[model samples]
Target: MSSEAEGRFHIVDVSSLTSVHRRMPRRVTLRTDDGVRIEAVYEPSRASVTDTAVVLAHGFTGSVDRPAVRRAARAFAERGASVVTFSFRGHGGSGGLSTVGDREVLDLSAAVRWARELGHARVATVGFSMGGSVVLRHAALEAGTVDAVAAVSAPARWYYRGTAPMRRLHWVVTRPGGRLVGRYGLRTRIDRRAWDPVPLSPVEAVPLIAPVPLLIVHGDRDAYFPLDHPRSLAAAGGDAAELWLEPGMGHAENAADAELLARLGDWLVGG
Candidate 1:
């Protein structure tokens, strides 16, 4: 064989590649209270019905097609659980505008209802970045409905005491120049107002989720939310919650790390 062909054959790890795609197609459109249709992809359980379901929420300016979102869906589905991933209003193929975490909470509630209607007795949520805050807040407000929650790199206090980097990012995105250009062509005026980085303040809501298992994961080197936020959240939850402070990982590592995936899977499995 040619040297290039030999190298390619050696580098390919066939064992890691699936011979066929095992994922099934799932399309759901949830109608919000305001008459907006929210787009979501549901991945049903590959194993028997465990009365458990997993919901994946994307970060700000993100869509359900994000790499992390897809990996999470596949990860949970492979574990014999159902997975649902959706785009926030004004994000991806969803309708309406982003209202930061304030209005997005309603969208999340709608998702939870959808999961319940699908016959999932126990529902857990996993969110990344801003989506993390949404899940945290939802779990707090709707404690009776959500069985558990895992938030990766979520900001605990956004309105105040947020990390400096995130504060700066908020400024940049909401600034006149940033708003005027409108990166996504989302109606600059509406987009600019929606991009405001107001904190969702999950700290206040932490106690509400007590007794309900919570998993907080944050990268020590996270530039967006910083480690303090997760620490605060875990501390607020006391012994009821688990905090995984990855030494070298940065934000959104849970979507890629096998160890992190295992931890999350175990939590969802009632370990």
Candidate 2:
């Protein structure tokens, strides 16, 4: 990789074969509040952009190394925004089992804190699917945690099996046999435990994220959660939230295109 100065822009050429397609430059282990150690990667922004940072939370069954997550991170970094991506517990190299979205807030909190420690004055949290729900809850639970929040392909409320994909997901998350498949087949370790108090719903958490800029992105063609999901979240988010329903998109981070990701990166830093 080589760095060159061009007026106000700081250009980093990562296209060289020796440095292309490699992992991030900085990698660290963060400990969640519940004592789970998670693996996180930090991609520094271009020299011109050093004050704002974006933390990415992957969806259920996804890791920091997942292609979709990495693509999004690289997109943000390429646009001169520092990006931090981490695996929720039980997903990749992280410790502990996945409680789905229930206990994942701790994971995001740790990542956000790390970004702040890295000298970023403004931080944004962007999440997909289960991670999206987690970001809402985290923002609600930990006030002043982030300057902006973006949730993509997230369910407004939990326990809905309306779509066939959701039905299959229910089977994967609720049944013992399904969990066995998740552990072995999907390589996603789902805890055999249940939500005790059911935690907090994303719609309920939306109002609590007030005074902070919020962007809700979802595909109109998403097979997992339909339009009603983002609609409900926007309704709850009120005037502080902006919602974008894409026409031909599918699901989560995987469905995000280069242009959409660039727009999201701009939104994070108030561009």
Candidate 3:
């Protein structure tokens, strides 16, 4: 793995952009710190109302091309901030298998770097499910690289199998047959090995992200993680972080409605 953390873009004819193409979504490829190829899309803001760019991260089985991910990105763009949506390695057009949220921090970092390289004065990240945990860890690890971070339906701690969805998720990542299902059924490639050193959990990383404007948004009806997960993260974040418990909501990106996404965009740009 190369020590280089900044990403290099590919496939997007990033030459001089005319006003006509400036609003079109441009597809690009990114190389991560550990050297993984990622697929991404860059969408210019509708109104160009904010200098902040929003980097969006998807869920466990989600990708940059997923409807939920695209919806969030479009909504953010409509709010007047450029948006970069990327598929983590192993999902979509990216290369490599998923390490869940551990090594995925590098993935988010790459997207953030790309957003900054595009000349955005500030960058904010909003991630869902597996990606939710990645944003917290990435902000904590990269510190001031990003202006703000928001995580939705993220688990506070690791190895949580309390919920039925989580228990099934464990099966999908750990077992060989489950891995096959993850690959063939869900189009998500699973890494066969478990965490060697067991990276820091989201709650553990929350304190490190203090004063960076962290937001933890979770649903009261999340089937993957209970309210305790967000509560634990909020407690760790203390006053530095804001917690929003969405009533009657479900889980991850699919559950994130336009209203919630618009509210998220408002909070991110405001922060």
> Best by lDDT, which number?
3
Residue by residue across 136-165, what tens digits does model 1's lDDT show?
898887778888888888888865435676
TM-score of each candidate structure, all chains considered together? 0.81, 0.90, 0.92
Off by over 4 Å in 2: 1-24
Q: How many residue pairs clash in each candidate at the backbone level?
A: 2, 0, 0
* Pairs with backbone N, CA or C atoms under 3 Å apart (clashes), candidate 1: 158-199, 159-199
lDDT of each: 0.70, 0.84, 0.85
lDDT of 2: 0.84
Weakest lDDT window of 10 consecutive positions for candidate 3? 1-10
Q: Write the per-residue lDDT of candidate 3 for residues 116-219, one digit (tens) a residue.
A: 76767889999898998999999888889999999999999999999888999999999999999999999988788788889989999999998989899999
**Considering lDDT, which of the candidate structures 2 and 3 is the better prediction for this target?**
3
Off by over 4 Å in 1: 1-24, 160-168, 180-182, 185-200, 253-255
Ranking of all predicted structures according to TM-score, beginning with the best and ending with the worst: 3, 2, 1
lDDT of 2 by residue, 63-151 (tens): 99999999999888877788989888888877778888988898899888878776677899999999999999999999998999999
